[model samples]
Target: MAESDGQERTEQPTEQRLRQAREKGQIPRSKELGTAAVLLSAAAALLMLGDALGEALSMVFEQSFRLERAAIFDPATMMPALAEAIGGLMWPLLGMFAVVLVAALVGNSLLGGFNFSTQAMMPKFSRLSPVNGLKRMFGVQALVELLKSIAKVVFIATIAIWLLWSQFDHILRLSGETLNLAMKDALELLLWMGLALCLALLPIVAIDVPFQVWNHTRQLKMTLQEVKDEYKNTEGKPEVKSRIRRLQQEMANRRMMAEVPTADVVVVNPTHFSVALRYDKDKPGAAPVVVAKGLDEVALKIREVAREYQVPVISSPALARAVYFSTKLDREIPDGLFVAVAQILAYVFQLNAWRKGQGNKPVPLKDDLPIPDEYRV
Candidate 1:
């Protein structure tokens, strides 16, 4: 088990961890499985093509040995004779090679799928250290591999002894048979023995496959701190995120405060809420847009900025609260509040006219204005 800063690694590796390990060529592998596949594949090919292979070998033997006296004496004839002999056996040999090649590929693919990592091929100076080499040679994984090898040798030897003992009578009878028949019987016996040996490897493969997978996972296990660090790297640190959010809020507030000067009127809910509105005289059909709206301290700040800019601050509790809650910044007030806001804008326009001596003083805006039921926040 691996550890981080005195903490034991017990957590399963994350997807990112596993992917990184794979990139470095750290993946589960079973030598037993690969060996079994090669042996079994070769045994199957031999079983299927044994007669054809035997006939080819026999033909090659006859050609090489049953030569004319003149041809045997001629060194120039030897190369052609060898070529003919090789051609006779080529197809059967090729068939066996093809089967073994396919088996090796399929067997290895069964476990870790397939990944080609160039990093695995890169040379590392750490691997050349004598201390590291000794550590690896005497490691827990090395011990396990040694035990498995010993067990395989013992198991296979026992199987071989038992097989020979059981087939003793048939082996002795082969010596008394004709050369052709004996060769055929020997080929058949070898094929059967190869199959039995391959079958004997299956139990080892079964044990080794799971052990390799488990060991690989164990090696990649993460400690508690490692998991937290990985999360921080992936999602970002909380303090940093908080700072970003605070900065973003500050920037937005500065922009909102900037809009306060341009507002036509700042409606206030006494001391609790404030909403700044601006009507575009150029677009007569457009409703007034709430350039800024805030609560509590922010509301006080809006009012302060409004006063500094000499903007009209209308004290309307119901209307301010309604607009504050219902209207978003930079959006037009809802259609339900259109009539009430129109009255306020008209009053402000009239008040400005009277101040400029262009019209008579307007009537005071009644606190209990025509606020619709749904628009009342």
Candidate 2:
């Protein structure tokens, strides 16, 4: 609901979750659309059957009733029954139409999934609002729809003419054929005609599906600033994020300093730098790492802590500063400092000899030790 730096948001989505869902096949597998398509083909087939059968059925029914010259044939008597029959047939016809609709829904499920809504049926006074009505009247959507309808009409008409002309001779020449042959021919003709209709419909599907997908995607797009706002809604404020980062750094520093008390030595600048190192013969691959380090005032505090804890202290000002600033805790000492550190370590071990009652504490500040300029940190 506010804004955020774009860093926290997803960039190129692999859409892996969506892909996995597809692999799992969670979407509806509907036959409704395909069934509707086939039923539409069947309806065309039925129309052909109806055209050929209507005359024969009417003749048979008339003769069976023997209503040659009677008032029973009169509209006055039969019209009411006819209306009653039409009324009686209406509900079943509606039920059948509902089946066709269900077939369409099933087909949609097969495509991927069926998404349904009834929002259009809500009681909306907006439908009656004059301002909205005028907007709809002149809208680009309305203009586009009008043009689409005209194009549809022209296209369907052209297809109808072409198909019917191609079948003209067969359709007109259906006299000598038996009823069985007639019905069979009609069905065959219907199948081919249905296929032609599908071919004709191909252009509409090809043009519309991709266009609809493109338009829908565009509708969902946000400006870069709007993208930031959405991220804020999902994540949190920038100040809170900054505070979190600060807490993490403080925790890491505290943890690093806390380990210094266990260190065997706290090498220092004697006033302004400190690096605490630890070694274990068990881990020979890594000689030592700076467990803790600090500068200036913090460096003095480290020296005080080392003294209070009675850990050995060695003064190497430049090395202490270099280790404090350049090296990270929990990592091996830098290559340039290794030899110098080893020599200091050797002296410290000899001092260890003095503390063990086998020798005496060596005097401090000897120039004889191989302390080099680059090794001064």
Candidate 3:
């Protein structure tokens, strides 16, 4: 029933959504797996150190019960004896506890790496609501948890019953043995019982791990509109992005138009294209740079700017298109068009001289300017 924009959440969660969930400490974890690991660790530790622990306990009991009149009367002596006995008993058990703790840590880490988020620790008032609490108690997740608990109890009970039933003859024989022999047999029986219980939990843990992972993934499923909205949040909203692009174009156009007034000549494609060129002979190895270029309305604006500054404007559709395409703004024209551009510059200079009454008007501007064949298109 989970939906967004009237569409069900049929799609798998995206990477961004997964990352956010992890940041919020929502990761797949199996409590049953951790419990099984701890139980197994405790059983293994007891098997390995059981004899040492038993001896320590026996020594503590012997010391506590030893009848010494002077020790009983002296509070200091009795206190030291009691403390030593307790410490000796605790040392071996502490080692076993440490092993179980390590196993629990490793089990959890194997499932979800290491996740520490303060957001998960924060209190939520919604959890206190009676209606919400009832919903959670009767939810699918709650039912699954209840079933898992039942299965664990059944498995352990079956294992215990079978182990005890098979060892029934051994249990009866223990009463006829000496005290030391009877205690040894009982310890061995308990060890076997612990191992059987741990073994029974393995199958349950295996199923629970995958079930927890699948359930977590199902909860994070995203709808189509949710995916789109997340994409917009990560990339940017469409309208805002379009506005940014428009602003960038306006800034570039303004910069190009500003350079037109400083150009030596403006090459026009009659209506569609315009490119302004400027050459500085004083600057060594410098070719004419395209100071400005534009199309249509921008081209007309460039021509107006050129005319305001008295820069010459020549209508040469092929040359204008070639220069506009080949040259970048504020960069020199390509070497392939060197001869053709040089001829036009010479013509412009000659025309300028004639207008100053220093030389006769050079041949009138013609349609066939010395344009390179390669640049014609």
Query: How many residue pairs clash (N, CA or C atoms closer than 3 angstroms) in each of the candidate models, in the order given?
Result: 0, 16, 0
Best by lDDT: 1
Leading candidate by TM-score: 1
Candidate 2's displacement at residue 59, Å, is 31
Per residue, candidate 3 scores C-alpha lDDT tens digits across 1-377 of 55545788888999999998999999999888888889999999989888878778667767877848887899989889988888887988999999999998997778878899888889999989999999999998799789878978897898889888998999999999975567767777888788888988899888988888998899999988888899889889889999999999999999888888888899898889989999997899999999999989999999999999999999888889999988999999999888778878888999999999999889866677666777777
Candidate 1 lDDT by residue in tens digits, 1-377: 54446889899999999999999999998888889999999999999999999888878876877898899878899889988889989999999999999999988877887889999999999999999999999998789889888999999999999999999999999999987788889999989987998999999999999989998999899998999999999888899999989999989999999999999999999789999999998996888999998989999999999999999999999999899888889999998888889999999999999999999999999878899988787
lDDT of 2 at 302: 75
Q: What TM-score goes with each of the models?
A: 0.65, 0.49, 0.63
lDDT of each: 0.92, 0.65, 0.87
Better of 1 and 3 by TM-score: 1
Which of candidates 2 and 3 is the stronger one according to lDDT?
3
Q: Report the alpha-carbon TM-score of model 1 versus the true structure.
A: 0.65
Between candidates 1 and 2, the TM-score winner: 1
